[model samples]
Target: MAIPPGFLDELRNRVSVSEIVGKRVKLVKKGREHSGLCPFHNE
Candidate 1:
C-alpha cells in the first residue's frame, strides 16, 4: 500500500499534537503513533 505525503513526512520525527489537534489525523494503525508524548513543548 501507498502512504500519504504528510503522513510519511511527519513520521521522520515524532507525532505532534499541535499538528494533529489542528487537523484531521486518521491513524491507519492503532497505538503505533502514541509517540513519546505530545510533541508541542520541548519540556
Candidate 2:
C-alpha cells in the first residue's frame, strides 16, 4: 500500500502534464502553463 521513496518524483519526471491532460481536454500553451475551458464549469 505504501509507495517507495522518490517514486512519485521519478514517475512525474518520466511523464508530462500536457500528455496526461491532453487526453481528456483541449489544451493551449500560455507562457509556462497550459489552459483550457473547463467542461464541468465551462469557465
Candidate 3:
C-alpha cells in the first residue's frame, strides 16, 4: 500500500513525547516544553 507523502515527517514533527505521554501520565508545562513520565519506554 502507498503511504501518504510527508506523513512520516509530519508525524515526527507533531508527535511530541509530552503529547503521547500525556495520554498515559501526568504531564505539566515546563517553560517552553512539557514533562511527563516516559510512556513508550524507560530511561
Candidate 4:
C-alpha cells in the first residue's frame, strides 16, 4: 500500500520517528538523525 506524501509529512510533523523506534530499540541522536545497532541482525 502506498501512503500519500502529505499524510506522511503530517504524521512526521506530529511524531518523532526516533521516539517511536526507541520504544523497541535504544537510539542515539547523531546530527539530525538517530542511530542504533540493529537488533534483528545485531549490526
Candidate 5:
C-alpha cells in the first residue's frame, strides 16, 4: 500500500531524531546538527 502525502512530514515533526539516536549512541550537539560515532562501522 502506498503512503499518503504529508504522512512522513508529520511523522518527522512528531518524532525526535536526537532522542531516538541518543538512546543507542551518545550524541553531541554540534551547532544545528548532532555528531556521534558510527555504531555500525568499526571506525
Candidate 6:
C-alpha cells in the first residue's frame, strides 16, 4: 500500500524529533538540533 501525499509532512509537523528519540535516548540541545550517543553501537 502506498501512503497518501502530505501525510508524512503533516505528521512530522505535529510531532518532533526530540520527543520521539528522547523516549529511548538521552538527548542534549545543540543549537537547532539534538545530540546523543548511539543506542545500538558502542561509541
- Candidate 5 per-residue lDDT, tens place, 1-43, comes to 9999999999899999899999998899999999999999877
Model 4 TM: 0.70
Cα deviation of 29, candidate 6, in Å? 0.8
Tell me which of candidates 3 and 4 scores higher on TM-score.
4
Provide the overall lDDT of each model, using Cα atoms, as 2-decimal numbers. Answer: 0.54, 0.89, 0.79, 0.88, 0.94, 0.94
Q: Which stretches of candidate 5 lie over 4 Å from their true place?
A: none
lDDT of 6 by residue, 1-43 (tens): 9999999999999999799999999999999999999999988
The alpha-carbon lDDT assigned to residue 30 of candidate 3 equals 92
> What clash pairs does model 3 have?
none
Candidate order by TM-score, decreasing, is 5, 6, 4, 2, 3, 1
Residue 38 lDDT (model 6): 98
Give the Å error, residue 18, model 6: 0.6
Winner of 1 and 3 under lDDT: 3
TM-score of 6: 0.75
Give per-residue CA lDDT, model 2, range 1-43, as digits (tens).
9999999999999999788888989999999999987868866
Which of the two, 2 or 6, has more lDDT?
Answer: 6
Taking the tens digit of each residue's C-alpha lDDT, what string does model 4 give over 1-43?
Answer: 9988699889989998888889999998899888988979966
Per-model TM against the reference: 0.26, 0.64, 0.44, 0.70, 0.76, 0.75
Instruction: Please state the error at residue 19 of candidate 6 in Å.
Output: 1.0
Better of 1 and 5 by lDDT: 5
After superposition, candidate 4 runs with Cα above 4 Å error: none
Q: Compared to the true structure, candidate 3 yields what TM-score?
A: 0.44
In model 2, what lDDT does residue 32 have?
92
The predictions' CA RMSDs to the true structure, in order, are: 11.8, 2.0, 4.5, 1.7, 1.4, 1.3
